[model samples]
Target: MSIEANLEKIERLTSKVWRSYSKEDPLGHLSFNEYDYLKAIQAARVPIRLTDLAKELEVTKPSATNMVKRLERKGLVLRVSCSEDARSKRVMLTEKARAPLESESEIYTIIAQKLKVHLSEQEFDALNTLLTKALR
Candidate 1:
């Protein structure tokens, strides 16, 4: 009933929603760190530097490098020399990662559709706006 109580409830529900979304994908069996790396590469669209990936994931450089290496070995990602900086390497998603990303997107679409069954269009729009504002 109180503002704090409402906020807490929202946070809990949002976390559950995210977990549900994550689990819905058969290909999302990847660890959270791996999924984060894949998502970042998908979003970057360009060769992303290891330092930048580390910063984006809020992890250390060595941790990012290790993760990239794992993805590279799995054939999900490739490490390429940065054109702008000869000494630096960039991570790029390989075609192997694309199918998994697409599967995750489909999972989210199904989750969204299920949620829409419970929420009115206006309520969903307001929730989206609130989440965008919170991120900012």
Candidate 2:
């Protein structure tokens, strides 16, 4: 196979692997965007404003609000008033979200173990470095 074909195959496999995690989502019908927002909020460890979420994702504020609303309905996140500014709302993950987040992580660990069968340790490290560089 040509290098181009190999690269395309990698792209497909990467998307497939990432997309596979959501199928077992316990949050009912969380979309990829919602999962991303939840992941961002969980990673932040600080209360993040809806506007900030929008900015961080390079999306519109209304879009972020909509995503938050959906997550709110699912009981995965809550919109709390900012302590310093009551008028603004910050998003935070609820305890309910912890299970699904942990589950997704466990699934990734399993995926990594499966991937290890096909790549050497050095090759895996190189792949990670190259993928990060490509994103940048």
- The candidate that wins on TM-score is 1
Question: Where does candidate 1 stray beyond 4 Å?
Answer: 1-29
10-84: candidate 1 lDDT, tens digit per residue? 667666666876665544567977988999888887889999999998999999999999989888999999989
| Poorest 10 consecutive residues by lDDT, candidate 2 | 21-30
Best model number under lDDT:
2
Q: What's the CA error at residue 82 for candidate 2, in Å?
A: 1.5
Residues 80-130, candidate 2: write the lDDT tens digits: 999988889999999899677767776667666767789999998887898
Q: Which pairs in model 2 have colliding backbones?
A: none
lDDT of each: 0.82, 0.83
What C-alpha lDDT does candidate 1 achieve relative to the native structure?
Answer: 0.82
